[model samples]
Target: MAVEKFETSLKKLEEVVKKLEGGELSLEDSLKAFEEGVRQAAFCNKKLNEAEQRVEMLLKQKDGSFGKVPFRLDDE
Candidate 1:
């Protein structure tokens, strides 16, 4: 099968954990799936971080020019 898109990968990761937590997959398969899901989730998170950085880079000041802006990935 083709590699899933970022959004699809994220959704699949969620589903994977939900299924594993529900006791639907065997021990071995659950471990394997959890590993794969973790990898996908990391990819999704990286993409999200990159996108957020891009948005911050596009922020314009009152002078009507774009420049790098400070953006916090963590709310805390």
Candidate 2:
């Protein structure tokens, strides 16, 4: 799958949803929009997950140094 920037994908997905909800397109067009919207949503979700993982890996050292630490949801 081609990678799309999260912001761009999200904006496109929003436009697709607006078009779909407007009920102005033929069934075929609506289907196409829905498919593209799905793909965009998936891309946005993937990017968010990756960012969350990166944030979780970050650690602040006692001397104000930065380090890497495994992320743990339960520890929070």
Candidate 3:
């Protein structure tokens, strides 16, 4: 779909899901839609990881300034 980023892809996927949920598409089309959704899900997961790392790097300390912090997976 040539999305600029994972968030864009995820939004597109959400739209697709809404359309499919409307019960208007054929079975084959729905299957293809689901496959694309899986790919988008994976991309979103990767983007989430990268975003978490960036957030950790920019975390503010008690001094009201940014400081480096460990990127813990559970932080999200």
Candidate No. with top TM-score? 2
Q: Give the range of the ten consecutive residues with the poorest summed lDDT in model 3.
A: 48-57
Model 1 Cα shift for residue 54 (angstroms): 5.2
Candidate 2 ranges beyond 4 A from true positions = 1-4, 52-76
Determine which window of 10 residues in candidate 1 has minimal summed lDDT: 49-58
What's the lDDT for all of these models? 0.78, 0.84, 0.77
TM-score of each model, in listed order: 0.57, 0.63, 0.58
Candidate 3 per-residue lDDT, tens place, 1-76, comes to 3337876988978987887888888999998888888888888877766633244457778989887776657765
Tens digits of per-residue lDDT for model 2, 1-76: 3345667888999999999999999999999999999998998888877743254487789999999876767877
Model 2 misses residue 15 by how many Å?
Answer: 0.3
Going through the candidates in order, what is the number of backbone clashes in each? 0, 0, 0
Between candidates 2 and 3, which one is better according to TM-score? 2
Clashing pairs in 1: none
lDDT of 1: 0.78
A best-first ranking of the candidates according to their TM-score comes to 2, 3, 1
